[model samples]
Target chain A: MRHDDLCHEVVSNLPTHGDCFVARDATRNDSGAIMDDENKKQINERYEKHLEKGERFWPDTIFRDLIMSLGIFTLLILLATFVGIPAEPKADPSDTSYIPRPEWYFLFLFKFLALYGQLPVIGKIEWLATVLVPSVALGVLTLIPFIERSPRRHYSKRVLPISIMTIMVVGIVLLTLMSEVPTVSEDGSTLLGTLQTVVGIFIPLTAYVLLFVFKNNTRLMLWTTGLAAVSMIFISGTVLTLAPEKKTEETEVATTLVDQIFAGQDLYSVHCTECHGDDGSIAVIEGVEGLEGEKITPIHSRDVLYTITDSAMLEVIAYGRPNAGMPPFGKTYGGELSRSEMDYIVVFMRYMWDDRFEVPQEALKPLFPPLAEGEVPSYNVHILPIVKRYCISCHRPGKDNNNYLMTTYEEILTTGDNAANNIIAGDENSYFLQVIQEQPIMNPENPEEELIGVMPPTRPLKPNVVDAFLRWIMNGMPRTAAETGALSTTPTPEVTPTP
Target chain B: MWKNIYLWLDERIGFNDLNKNLLDRPEPKTTWWNTLGSASLFLFVLQGLTGIFLTVYYTPSPDHAYDSVQYIMEGVAFGWLIRGIHHWGATLMVILVFIHMLRVFYTASFKYPRELTWLIGIGLFLTTLGMGFTGYLLPWNQKAFWATTVGTQIAGTAPYIGEFILKALRGGPDLSALTLQRFFSAHIWMIPAALAGLIGVHLFLIIKHGESHFPTKDD
Candidate 1:
């Protein structure tokens, strides 16, 4: 009989309701070999007696059968949402100093290769582990089903294959642990730990030995896995135990400045995260009713928080005034704020401003008058020296200027793509004219318009140099001091105080 | 109806029940090499499950990928655990699929009649890896984002076809919204569909080949 006939016959014997062809077919085997009149059907079927146990892929595999599995997975996905991840504050482009790392999964490989790069002789082949080893490992893995196809189902004979697999698992897990852990010295500079000598080198050396000598046994794979896992755990735990806690922050039981700042966080969160944002950085302005295109400068940045003083910070917060954009917030301007309440806002601002700064407000004020037009203050004697000192550290050609080149006077004129278009002649309209204006309301907040991100990015412009450059720009912006003798004759010695 | 098709396939494709008991032939299954396909299938399920969990909050923007991933690592409850599982699971799947391919090649399982299945499997492997590489760039973090930038930049370095491939992979000349959306869709839908189809074809061929008979020849 055909296979389909056999399948139908097999299905009939199984338990089913009487409404279908199944029950009648099983009760009475009446059909003859209907192909011929001379031949009759076989009455006794050998396989039909034991019909309960069938083949692995018996019965129709329907879409409905698979949907339940899919449902379970869908439920798992739903559960993950509730148990979902927490997002860190959004990235700050200005904070280019933050070191980026890979996802935790890749961390093992990352940390592994970093270790491999430390090895000698074959060391430069560290890419072999980071790139090639994993590649080859997967290559060998995909090639497995073809290597040993003898139908040997037992584990004893499968030792070599299993060993190879175990080694990879162990290696990856160990590397992952190392990447995540902090480094610390073992012991208090006394006796070495009992396992230190063997732990450091012997273990790895022994694994290498086993790869050759004990390649066929399960022991090698087991040991390799064990050693990797143990080392990872030990290294991580020991480092964590001996590692110094953050050296900068101390618990101020006696009420320190940080404590006061911490106390003010709640108030700040309610009022500040809206504009300055949760991290005191990455300020994005949604269009509000009164404010269209209203953008608060990111405070989490090293620039704003780091540069201004606490008292100045308080005034800014209490007044809530910064040109036309920020409204006056204190009761003095019909906005609600007491002096102490204003101090709370200041505390929060200062805390965010400087991890180390704990100073008063006098530093942020403008002390000297900015140069007006027709004043030949100083350029060649003062301004040229300042450019050589502060501007060229990062803004030179063939460096990371993006496109901004300030290495030469020509490069300055070119400005490539983003020159200070705002620096208008005789008016405070150009980028060069607006940033660091004793009155800063004239310029757009875009940092790209200025040299060195508004120039001298980390420090303020010296008042004397500001006057010199201001005089030069106001005097129809002379590139060379031919007609205007503003310090053209005097050779001022370049004086940059060493950091 | 499908049963008729199976029989038709059996007769035409050199498939028979006797081939299952023919445990001495070396044309296919030689010893213990058949288990790899199973392991790879297992890991695929694991990765899919974990990946679905990760999609809950993984923003695809170039700017957000890093910070979001960091947040998941340090912020979510057992988020690191879920991420770890997904990460390790993907590594294992890739490893296993390669081994399966090797096993096929070493035994010459790709010879003639089974050649189509082998070719399809190879395509599936490449697709799987393509998925990983694309997914790798999605987190938009320092490593994921910049590594991707460097990776695409390397692709961009190709003589003439480089820029095209980079654009196709990155969804643009540089990493942007276009790149993120393209990668996200590919990771979630496109690659998965192709992988599923290939997996089905692979399984069908395995059953048709009847285990290639165990190794009776002496080593």
Candidate 2:
């Protein structure tokens, strides 16, 4: 009887047999005639013979499995201990600039969808790559046992399925490797895209077609799969080599409470210190462009900290009190700070000012490493952190700071209108030096007008900070620690006057 | 006194029958590749244990999820190790299961009496991926958030029911607190339960059939 007739018979007689296995076996007996009852009996006999000679599963198979599992356990612990998950910033639904990527395993499919989208007509149909291709592939994979019905166990006998799978697996791995390489370059060149299509989609596809055509010829099938896989790998390697170096975005994520507080403090100093005083104690904002003389509640006050929850505080900062003359600080509202940055600022306020939160000792460490008596302070070691904390808020671009941008070391010295006189090497009378010391640089043309106000109009730099600037300028403004080390003057007892 | 207690328990448990049926069965000679299946099982258990520990501290709300994870890493002792194992175990589980499937496919061990096992194995593989997808969103970090957004968006591309599927997966029109809560439920309870059930059947089938022998040219 035909397989359909047998299936119908089994279904019709399913109620008579209480055991479902009986019906299943009857259907299989007819459908799987490739391995007939005689063939199955012989296979069973062969398996029985092998079992007689084989080792016991208890000690042998179990032993290998235990060893493998133990090895994996060790590897997992090592990975967990040494390469812990990299910290990622909290989700910001409004941050559209973030390039979203799936977990590593799904990268192959991600690349496949991207490369497939470059196809002319069909690519426009989103479901073909996104839903259809994957569903079909998984369907084929799931039904492999029934699809390859030959019952051929050896690799030599199952050349078609084996070769197809080999090419498919190779394609998956290669596509994953090429996931970071964009299909199109920024300049709209499609060379990389076309090449990726070949590696990811075309080569494997062509090889599958050719393999089926050459199915009867095992050698030809193997050669097609081999050549296709090799070419895919080779072309992907070329694509990778030619690929532009990806710009690694350095976003410092503070993992520890101490680090978070420090990060928050630095951000608070730059962004908030202008409106609120350095300690968040200013009742009225002063010297700020639009909000001068505006009265505001002290954020550090117990009323504010105790009354406002963290979420409420976050919203207040992010949305800002428009009527109260406070501008939004969140990126979602067109401000500069990201969600994590805002979180850090909140953390800083809680630990530094709130009586409820106990601050960690490490968070209280000085901003920069303290200098020995004669040690020189470099731009990198001392000045950058100091500038970032105290100066960058106003000194940065689009601010009211006389076109002087302190965002970078070069810009600090070179960009301002008073660039020539801002940081004259070894000149104590430089405009930058004069301003930060609470010394206003008087306009030479009009002596009554201040060319620049004392730096950081809100608060004076601590004595140590001023001294570092003094040492940095006196040492001719070295940029690196190595450069500053060469200029260091060892403390000599001879130079010290007896008290 | 120990012997009397052991005897009493063994009488009820039938240790000898278990040894005969489960552990002491004869099999074809296996290789290192054959160990991948059991290794995958071991990883699953490891993940389950660590995941349970994670859920103790993990709050499934967008507002607290990120902070809770931070607290897990910072405030709770040995929380990092548990979370780390879970994180890496997930990646390792996917790899081992895939390789194990490949090994079974390449060896044609999925043929004849083992076809149902292969079918169940496929379910396990897909569910393992589902676990990864769901577990990823629980952290509610930028990477996890955006990845899930795009992931659900891709699911939403199916012709007829795509929108429904997307909504169903995300628990609404967009990823929100509800999406996080549902994903947390699926990750800890639903997917793992499905996996455990399927694993039990898979193990039963393996024991029933014994390991398949390496094929040779002899007919």
Candidate 3:
């Protein structure tokens, strides 16, 4: 931009105006070399004409592209909703053998794990490959385009990035395929060696190596990318076609204690045995800490079993006690249940409860303590435990729960969850009280009384025992053992019915 | 109330200065790709606000969990809208994170001074995903209950430490009120707090260096 550097035509265009002189002006010869004006005038005239003509900048209907993209997105959402996620019914903690796999988006990584997961001690290689490699690879990917320092924008010039992305896609496909088809077993021979064909992975991997070798060849990379995409789809399709059938002929597996009890035994060995003595029994009252300041409860007590139902018991089994030394059972909760099978659990619980076992049998009185002051004699000893024994089997937590017999002590003292809406609390008018009171245990001699789904639905208890509970709630329900010590151990005054 | 309050408050550092130190710092010359991280931050704010609104009426008790959520969806004013915002915001955050990572990769920003930030970003992204994973289980419905069970099962498969991971997550030997409570705590505090700390360090590192050198030949 120095005065001497201007074209000859631009220097002549400067007029001799007052006090405004170009450095190239003839006055005083101040470096009078500059572009002459005639050429500059011509160039400026041509540019002015170009602007006066008014060129167009944009096309009409610009909204169409955006509208179309939004419309497509909305339609896809509707379609996906129709596909809808699958959901299971209320979870049963008692059933511990549920197999879990991720959604399809993560299936490729999952398949990778399946292939390399059990790799002879060192096979933890897949975890690093899947987690760390993908993570680091993705990290490098974010920084790479900037790092390459290539001024060119087109793929024709950006050789390294394109090749790396291609190889990455191929590697993912191979790993996913390997996970799905880890072996060419007998089933592969069934349909033209389908499993072997599924394991048909050599060509693509070879191509990946070839791509790395010939990274600069644009034509080869393009062709290989096209081929890889098609193969990925085809392999994924074959996997879907050959995957184990979704609906296994519904095997009517009997839900029984055999498997669970045994599974429980093995589970206890790793998790519970140290604290609860290989049985459910904890010497310390639960919520009361032992020597190690661990809160624990013994399982053998009748009070504990009555306090919670079978399903509740299963939850306690599967998830270990909190604030207590009891470690969680089963891998379901991230504990040691990883080693045991379901069949072993049933055997453990059954054995623990067996009467022939040599366990402490302190006086029954210690097992069932006296009612504290203001605590009802009928409830602490007779009524509540009986309800726990009978009604709670169906109505307790994790069960049928049509009537909430898992009612708290506060609930026993006041209204139930349904409240005055369904049951009138202690009023004989309460539907639950009415139903249980009127229903017969199992009496063929009485015309008004036969078997009824009274409460437990397991087995009816002694009739006088039922009568004792009914009398307490039916009356004003006086409490406090000091006030009614005579009724403490009195067999029910009503005639005991023979079932 | 005044004397003790003044003494207690005065003992602490200036809250305004603390905030200024974090937010009012200079921004380097970031490219378009760096915008996704900001987008993720926006979505996180959206989730936090919507979540707090949802929690106002949500009852966590198992018997009532399903009912409470349905009530939010059908009965509460603007509840469904807020929920839709939160849910879609979660998905959008995931997408934004992926885009941000891709942008960084395409630009080679993970190199040199940025590597640790990249690693921390990776951890933050996964923690974000984990937050999304664990938060859905709180409702204790059919979908939340089992989906989370399956999710925890994936953690249960982690080599060697998988079992410990699952147990710590579940809060017991099984999924219970304990699991829900622990997850809620994590969703609210652990993951979000981790994200904040990680993001603070990430931005701090970015400011320490010049904006990543844009691709140019012999410039």
Top-DockQ structure, candidate number: 2
Ranking by TM-score: 2, 3, 1
Alpha carbon lDDT of each predicted model: 0.53, 0.88, 0.52
DockQ, cand. 2: 0.74
Best by TM-score: 2
lDDT of 2 by residue, B26-83 (tens): 9888899889999999999999889888989999999999999999998999999999
**Which regions of candidate 2 are displaced past 4 Å?**
A1-33, A368-382, A425-429, A437-439, A462-499
All-Cα superposition RMSD per candidate:
23.9, 7.9, 20.3
State candidate 3's DockQ: 0.09
- State candidate 1's DockQ: 0.04
**Model 2: per-residue lDDT, tens digit, A1-499?**
4655665677576432212323444554533226667657767888899899998998999999999999999999999999999999999998888999988889999999998888999989989898888989999999987788765466666778889889989989888899899888999899999999999888988998899898677678878988998899899999999999998898899988888998998899788887887789889776688887888898899999999999899998899989998889888998888899999999999999999899988778777999998999988888998888777877777878789888998898789889999888899998888988999988899999988888778678899999999889988999999897679887444776768
DockQ per model, Cα: 0.04, 0.74, 0.09
Q: Identify the superior model by TM-score, candidate 1 or candidate 2.
A: 2
| lDDT score at residue A395, model 3, on the 0-100 scale | 43
iRMSD per model? 11.4, 1.0, 11.6
Assess every candidate by TM-score.
0.40, 0.91, 0.43
